[model samples]
Target: MSQQQDLNLFVDNSIIPQKVYRDEPLFGVITHTQGTSPSWLINLLIENALYGTCVINHEKNQHRQLRSNVVVISFLNDFDFYEKDLKRNGIEVNDNQQFHFIDLFTDLFQKINTPESIVKIFDQLSKTIQNIPNKKTILIEGIEFLLSSTGITSIQLLNQINKLNKIADALFIITGADKELIDIQHANPSLPEFKTLDFIIRLLHRSNIVLGLRPLETGRAKDITGTLTISKGTIPFDSLVVSEKEYLFFVSRETTKLFFR
Candidate 1:
């Protein structure tokens, strides 16, 4: 928005509310349209949690007084890709001791084919963070990918997520809200698309905050890429304070810029 607003940027990153997440656990959900990418936003969050500050995020001047250990379970991108992006934002994912990336994208073959397989995955994922001594912030990208790939049901997946959620100081789930995924015209509970839509809806209901992204409603503009909307969730914590806000953002090869919408 403005230089003055940058002084108070996201609660200290004011769009992100770093203060509210300092002590208690935080659960956030982000949904993106098909053409809009949430990767840059996710990278910014990782930077905020790991470094406790923002360098080239939406606003470079924002600050995080509390740093957290970050664990990311990504189903859409590989380590190499994320590593490259984060490096631009000052995170050395490979060398950092507190940053962990679980590459479910490249290693999706570890699918849950049976009930025992599901347990193995649940235990493995949990143990990964249980060993970490610091306060943990876990981010899951494309968790819905698990639905189509594994035999695990939506209820079962949500249960595992809830248990994992309890382990972290902050948890963020990123999913696609593209209409194709959520369309219910010929709803089939058996399909993973419908299953994923249901899963995302439940998450939205429980999440304290939701950061949503979508393509420009009007025709494309050279300077703007998409819009980011932050809204309080259905069951947000009474203590969690956030106002519904929107921003026009542009992500370029080297940096991201934001403008009041």
Candidate 2:
């Protein structure tokens, strides 16, 4: 398929209003993996945001005029991990002013000795964002991991996200939505898994776009990585047009490949 066709099949943002803040375009990536993993889709979005363009097969495929600086708040991986991945993909995001990576995976818990420290994180993030003088997009990964590790309730974490959104221009989040996480049978609110499921469901209701990634029902294959379902969130704008579709995707050594159904 042509690159344009592929872009549309994935998500043609031209059809999206791309509003931020109150009408901010919230995109959710429902990853089955319990913890951090190398997600090709997340990296792709980061690259596009940083460069204001999309490069596919060593060529430019699309151009976005309004490029937003990226702030990565990762509970999944550290800076070195993402830096290495981007380097392997021929993009050097590290040290670039447009890209800022915050490693919540390392040393975050060690520093959270007091209950007050939990709230301090939001303050820290707000200050970090205030320093950046550009349209900002926050990429949050491993929120489930954070909820499981920290003492914050699902509502509190969701509120924190909204608090950050009040200052951020856009938001992109990655959370787990596996059966174990979302199951409500004999649900216990005290359990971290339950809180995580609650947080994700609430976010889904507010998201503008949702991407569900899971293993194939037919099982794994050498060429196929997994299945990706792209659809609008439960509360998309009335005037918006969403292309709900599913496709097979592969994560190769050099780049990602998407196959339309």
Choose the strongest candidate by TM-score. 1
* Candidate 1: regions farther than 4 A off: 1-22, 57-66, 110-116
TM-scores for the candidates: 0.88, 0.85
In candidate 2, what are the lDDT values of residues 1-261, reduced to their tens digit?
523224332234432234442354555445555322336767767776666455453345544354677889887789988898777655787557788898877866797533367668877888878788867878888766667777788887777777677666667788777777677776788787788778888888887677778777777788777777878777765455667887777777786777876
Count backbone clashes in candidate 1: 6
Top of the candidates by lDDT:
1
Model 1 lDDT tens row, 103-197: 77765665645646766787889987898886888999987877776777778889988878978888899988877777777677778778888
lDDT of model 2, residue 194? 84
Error of 2 at 94 (Å): 3.2
